[model samples]
Target: MYQFPKGFLWGAATSAPQSEGAALKDGKSPTTWDKWFEMEPELFYDQVGPENTSNTYELYKEDVANMKAMNLNSFRTSIAWSRLLPDGKNLNPKAVAFYRDYFQELVDNGVEPIINLFHFDMPWWLMEKGGWEARESVDHFAYYASVAFEQFGDIVKKWATFNEPLVHIECGYYGDAHWPKVHDFKRAIQVGYHTLLAHAKAVAAFRESKYNDGQISIILNLSPVYPRSQEPADLEAAKWADHIYIRSFLDCAVKGDFADEFVALLKEADLAPVTEAGDREIFLNNTVDFVGCNYYQPMRVQAPEVAKRPISDPHDLFAPYDWPEKRINPHRGWEIYPRGIYDIAMRLKESYDNIPWYISENGMGVSEEERFENLDGIIEDDYRIEFIEDHLAELHRAIEAGSPCFGYHLWTFADCWSWLNAYKNRYGYYRVDIKDGFKRTPKQSSFWMADVIAKNGFSREQI
Candidate 1:
């Protein structure tokens, strides 16, 4: 039996825009995502936008009931900044009332609500003012965070300042997967620095607030970097990849400073972000109480091929290589390396002092949903069940080796709108039928997960 500790948090996570439908209702303003969808509908799958998602805004109570039915002891959801503070300054009373009622409903259903301040839904007005690239935007976010803490701190014992900050930096700034898609390395670095600053400022605000007893953290999607070969060049390539992708934010959040070598390399390349006076102290003084890590896959790096012409794109510096022999999830196009979770846990334990981390997001997203339907009219997702089991077995191994992991939250509770991909890929225990009046149907994996949560673990026979 792979038994987890007693009271280990068993829950699922969902973001506001991904699940909540009411985009412009109750004094809500448009986020950058809302504006992006309007500007380029074709960028989304089948032109599906976030205007009408799973209707969680109006059906949160029913969702909480579903959570309770699944035996979930905790649920992680983000507060829509556009909903709470439409202008990014004033609080919307209607939105405030809605969140109070919604969070209370989760608590009423015996599910601990884990609140996150930002989940890639920046206010359009704030984006117009340059978003995270501008230092002033950091102050704006800190003010918004302070309001959230003052308002919801009593009910919510766990708060995350930002969910996947590097995702916004990489996708929105470096890649084109998210809103405000800009492809500039310098801008990406500036935005990343400002984001880390905003997190630190929020941590400082939370510490000074009257409701400072609760734990606060930042959720990072930490993927370990691995060399594709034992060659020195491949190992060096992997080191660079880890420095740029993992240590860039992890060091700043945990150690309260950027790695000197990393900073020096960026400076040498004229890509270092501009730092203001006293910003160093802000980060140094307010390290997170804990860290929320979301592991999906390991990164395979190899030495770059020499080219006659100069390489201009900064993304090519790390030289990310795909191993043809690596195990892969055909549907989602992600590498399937369950051992990466244990590697990440060990890294946290040895490097970050094992400061009470948890798996905030881990799950399988698959295509071809129709093929999974069974004779009982449910999604018999045995693949997803096996995926979770394998990952949990690795996680159990890490915990047994003295990793301070207290919880595990799957990527989502239900199939909802994903950014860019929209509803093309579904990653949920409960499947939501978008065409059928947004119906929620529990998949086979949901029942399996319910049993796992009830037993506090799983045995080989159960699998």
Candidate 2:
């Protein structure tokens, strides 16, 4: 049996924008998601919008009860900036009260709440001010972080500054998948830089707050970059991709600066974001106490095909190379590379001084899960169990190989709504029936997960 270390945090995660359904209620301002849905309802799957999420805003107590029942010792979720500060400045009394009671409930149930400050649900007012592209957004974010720490920092010991911040840069700025949809690489770089600066400022705030010893992190959705071949160009392309996507934020948050090669690349392309003289000091002085790694897929790339490259575009440095033998989750169209977890841990150990980290988010999303419901009215999600087990096996290998991994958290706790995708892909041990009052019901995997938590290890024979 492969045993997890003592006090391993067995947990699950969900974001406020994805799980909480009250979009524009109780003095809450509209987020970019709510406004986007209002502008283009057709863009979302089944025309579902942020207002129709898991209704956790109203059903949070039940959610906590479910977590306790599932043997979850910890839960990671984000506080909606719009909810906490409706106008992005003043605190909302009702919102503060709601979060306090909710977090207290989690603690009362023995589930430590790992709260994050941002999860891409930018308040529309902030987006109107150019969002992360504006330097002022960094100050506003720092203020918001300070307020959060002052309010609930005592109850929520573990805090994250941002969740998958690269997604905001890539999807919102470089692609049209998210809010403020624009296809400008220069804008993406600025947004990414500003976001990192905000994270550093938040870390600084956490240090000054009374809960200085409490853990603070930035949850990065990291992907291992693979080359198409062992050729010099392919290897160089892969390394460049890694620097841009993974190391850019990883190094800044963990090691306190961007790689020299990455900075050179930015300067050569004339794509560097504007920065103040003291920004470097802010980053260096406010490095995070830990890291939260969200691994789902790997990036396979080769050198760009054309001889000439566009100076404005970052993608000009590399070209995507789809692996023919890659196993994929057909439901979500993501590569199922379990070994990437081990690879990521080893890289962190060797390259980044082995910072204490956790599998902040890792789970399989399946479509039409109700089709697998058995006669007992429970979804027989043995496939989800198998997916988690495979990943956990690789995590065990990483732990044994001297990786400083302390915990593992699945992507979600309940079948919550995804932005744009809505409820298309369900990733929860407890199936939340959206049609039937958002009822929560445990699937087969929940029982299996409970047993794993109880034992702290599992053998293949159990399966």
Best by lDDT: 2
Model 2, 62-152: lDDT tens digits are 9999999889999999999999999988999989999999999999999999999999999999999999999999999999999999999
After superposing candidate 1, which stretches have Cα over 4 Å from the reference?
307-313
lDDT at 86 for candidate 2? Answer: 91
TM-score per prediction, in order, is 0.97, 0.99
The total number of steric clashes, by the backbone 3 Å criterion, in model 2 comes to 0
CA RMSD of all predictions = 1.5, 1.0
